[model samples]
Target: MSRRGWTLFLAMSLIWGLPYLLIKVAVADLAPVVVVFGRCAVGAALLLPWTVATGQLRPALRRWRPLLAFTVLEMTGPWLLLAYAEQSLSSSLTGLLVAAVPFVAALAARLTGDEDRLTRVRVAGMLLGLAGIVALLGLDIEGAQLLPLAAVALTVVGYATAPLVISHRLPDVSGVAASSIALFVTAVVYAPFALPRLDRLDDASGTAVLSVVVLGLVCTALALALFFALIREVGPQRALVITFLNPAVAVLLGVALLDEPFTLGLAIGLPVILLGCLLATWRSRPRGAMPVPAIDAAA
Candidate 1:
């Protein structure tokens, strides 16, 4: 990778990885809906200049159905699930769970014939990934809250479903426009649920507000810009190395910031999942630079 490309890769990784920590902060008092809503609204607002400046608005506006479907599947559905999951899980742990996304995408691809040949190694990777999740979440009925765990499970499905949506339904749309419109749809849908709490929101810590704002603008908006740039300079395969780095960063933040518990589950589960994801996504085929669209990878 060129120096410029290396910079973009690191920047994008930090931007994406830091969100788990920030989301934990943002949801400290706010409901998951509020947190999701705020992030989406802020992201949409921040994204406007680019869409308007580039004159993509009219063209995008014309493609409303598929665009809105992208919003529903990629943005709104997946995000709310993440926020709900964070109520029980820390940012770092959530990051680790999200690492399973690539494997999920692989499975979805096989089912859909997007990448039809699923080898034994890939199947092994998926099983390992599932085992990791089961171990991490645990089977002890007494120790767990079913709702939160279910929320995380839903987040996993959302992650898996996302790649299918983009790959099949919205492939030609500009990534920036796609991301921004999705955020806009998320904001619009979550508004009614969040607005009643706006006045109550002022009492929350300044730290939380800062976390949300930074997450919306920097973690998402800035990170996405860098993601596209990195794909261009280094190509997608190398730039995709950042995805492997995110779970580690999340674990660090969970330990350092939230003082979340370190369990045997995380210790054993994280590595298993990461290794599985690595094998599942590792390809021998030739490549061109393309963004690692995690939202789309949710499938």
Candidate 2:
């Protein structure tokens, strides 16, 4: 990958990863629904004009049904769920759970006819990653009655479905357009609940507002742009390796910024998750897509 691709990927990793920490901060003042809605609204605000300028708006609008499904699955359902999950779970844990995306995507791709050979290397890496993931689930899955584990499982499904939606339903759509539309769709979906509390956001601190804005403009929008660029360079399969970096940043931020716990278990598990990420995206280099940036891995 070129220097720019690596730069974008690393930036995206941190951008996406930081959201977990930001959610932790935002929940201190705003409700999860409002926060999620605001994220969408702000992201859409950031991208709406470009979408219009590019003349993709009408075509995107005409494909509302699939777009709606993509929005619900990609943005609304899981983003909201992760926000809610953050109400109970830690940011580091959220990052850990999301690490399954590559594994999930690989399985989904195989099911969807990606035609990539499932080499022994890939299979070993996937399983090892899962084991590391299981190890990281320090919480007794049986005892955490609320099933934070299960909540994250659904989050994994959301992550898995996002790429499929992009490749299948919105292949013609640029990543910017798809993400912006998803944000807009998120705002629409959550409006009934979020609109009622618009005034409540006024009570939030400047930090919270800034966090939400960065989350939208930088993370979701810019990260998606970098993501697609990487996909174009390296193809989605190989470019997906950055998922590993994103979670690492989240964990690091949690420890440094949020004072999140960094137990021996977390120490053990983090490496495994990173390893899984590497394994899953290891051979994805086909040189068809644009070279990916590795700057930050929040995405």
Candidate 3:
């Protein structure tokens, strides 16, 4: 990667890594629905105008079926679940759990016919990633609530599946436009639930409010723009490597700023999960075979 690519890559790692911490902060005062709504609305507010200015809005809207599907799978479901789960789970652990996404994405891609057969290395990667998750749950958390853990698991699956929706179904759509529309729809869908809770914001702390704002403006909108640029600079496969780094940043932030524990499970599981992700996503091409197009893996 060039200097510019490295810059974007690092920017994305920091930016995307931030949401776990931000969500943990925001949900301290706001309802999970409100946090999700605020971020989506803020992100949509910025990206929608750019989509229209670029004349990509109509093209994206024309594919509303897939756009809506992408929204539910990516933003609507995962964002809320993450926020809710953070109420019980530490941001560090939550971030590490989501690191399983690549392992799930490997299977999702094969099931969706978006990739070649899963090699033995990829299968081993999946098992290793699963072991890491078990270690985190067993060692880091004491008698973890089933519901929150289930929510995180579902969030992982949703995150993994959303990219396949983009790669397979909405391949031609402008990524910015699709993301803008998805964020808009998510805001709209959650408006009823969130609007009713607007009164609650009056009692919310400045930190909580700022966290939501940052999540929307910086994490969601700006991060998406930079991620697209990163893809253009380094290509999607290289850009996807940011996924491995994000949880590390998340863990560091949680530990330093929030004083979350740097537990035995985290110390052990983080590197193991990351190694599994690296091997799981490794691609090899046969002679004369067409190169597999990389899927969008930005979280």
Candidate models: Cα lDDT each: 0.65, 0.71, 0.77
Clash number for candidate 1? 10
lDDT of 3 by residue, 1-299 (tens): 56876788779878998998889889999999999999999999989988899888888788889889888988899999999999999876787678677667766766667534567775676667566655544537676799999999999888777766666577667778888888998999999999999998889999999999999999999887676566555543345556666776676676788798988977887677667655654545544675534433432
Candidate number with greatest lDDT = 3
Model 1 agreement with the true structure over 26-133: per-residue lDDT tens digits: 788778888888888888887766777887777777878877775675568877888887877766456655656656655566677653345666567666755765
Q: Predictions ranked by lDDT, top down?
A: 3, 2, 1
Lowest lDDT sum, 10 consecutive residues, model 2, at 290-299
Which segments of model 1 are wrong by more than 4 Å?
A: 1-12, 116-142, 225-244, 254-278, 286-299
What is candidate 1's local distance difference test score?
0.65
**Model 1 residue 231 CA deviation in Å:** 8.6
Worst 10 residues of 1 by lDDT: 290-299
Candidate closer to the true structure by lDDT (higher is better), 1 or 2: 2
Query: Per-prediction TM-score, please?
Result: 0.74, 0.81, 0.81
Angstrom error of the Cα, residue 141, model 1: value is 8.4
